[model samples]
Target: MTTAPAGPDPTMQAIGQAIAEGRAGDTTSARQKLLSLWSVIGATGDPLHRCSLAHWLADLYDDPAQALAWDVRALDAADAVTDQRVQEHHAGLHIAGFYPSLHLNLADNYRRLGSFEAATEHINAARTHAPSLPQDSYGDLLRGAIQEVAEAIALRDRSRRASAPGSTA
Candidate 1:
């Protein structure tokens, strides 16, 4: 006899259904519902629930850093259950989503803070994670542009540092 996979908590199941529908174009109340369910999934240490929640949050929210943070937690829970699916999801988010997002956010924040060197570093980091595309795809071109911007900022910072009022150049 085949046994059914144990289902998640009723509340979590409800949140999961909502998140799925939200992804299909229903966000009016989806965000609030997911937020409310986050703590519950987190507390239960349920990898499936946590992974589902993280993916939903990432899509509904534009904050990569926050999404990455959630993904990290989800990964931890997944690890506890020895779940390969959860590991794959976590890796995909990092390799395809969070890394680039964090790179962009870091670059923007550094530029705004007048930390040109820091900005350049983030840009390079982002490039490292960027996906390869057609021989000359738009994403490749964009990544190249970001790299150039970072390099220019790094050079400016270096020049400023060298010219600063200090005993050593």
Candidate 2:
């Protein structure tokens, strides 16, 4: 007999799914649902709840500047989740596990707003944290994402330099 892998809190799972739905193009409904969940989770909720809600909520905004604000909140919430509390809320979760993705999102948001320096800073942080992730598919995916973002940043830099005055292709 096969056992299903344990998941996060039911509320968190639902919120995550709603965020995925938003990512998959149901922004209007997903935003409403996420806002509702955020209300239930509250500001002083469990650290895990706050982290998950804020992380997912970051993506709901059309404006990268607004999204970056939510990303900062998510990172703060993740940092607030101590090891003891992590074990209590979800055995598999660790603050280290959240860093790469959080940094990646921050990098993307910064890049979107044309803040290349800040974006590169977060990308470097993400790369530093990448190896600490579990040696699993998700970890691999995050690493891939980090590489992709790095390449994109490099390409953007090249393009910018190429277009600068007195610059040769």
lDDT of each: 0.52, 0.75
Which pairs of residues collide in candidate 2?
none
lDDT (Cα, tens digit) per residue for candidate 1, span 1-169:
0233343356556766877767666664676788778866565656666655654554454443454455455444434444444344333222233344346444544554567776777777767766632234545655665665565566554222221111120
The candidate scoring highest on lDDT is 2
* Candidate 1 C-alpha error for residue 26, in Å: 2.7
What TM-score would candidate 2 get against the native? 0.78
Per-candidate TM vs. native?
A: 0.41, 0.78
Give the C-alpha lDDT of model 2: 0.75
lDDT of 1: 0.52
Evaluate residue 2 in candidate 1 and report its C-alpha lDDT on the 0 to 100 scale.
Answer: 26
In candidate 1, position 30 carries an lDDT of 73
What is the C-alpha lDDT profile of model 2 across 62-133, one tens digit per residue?
677877887898998888888666665566566787899999888877776778888899999999999778
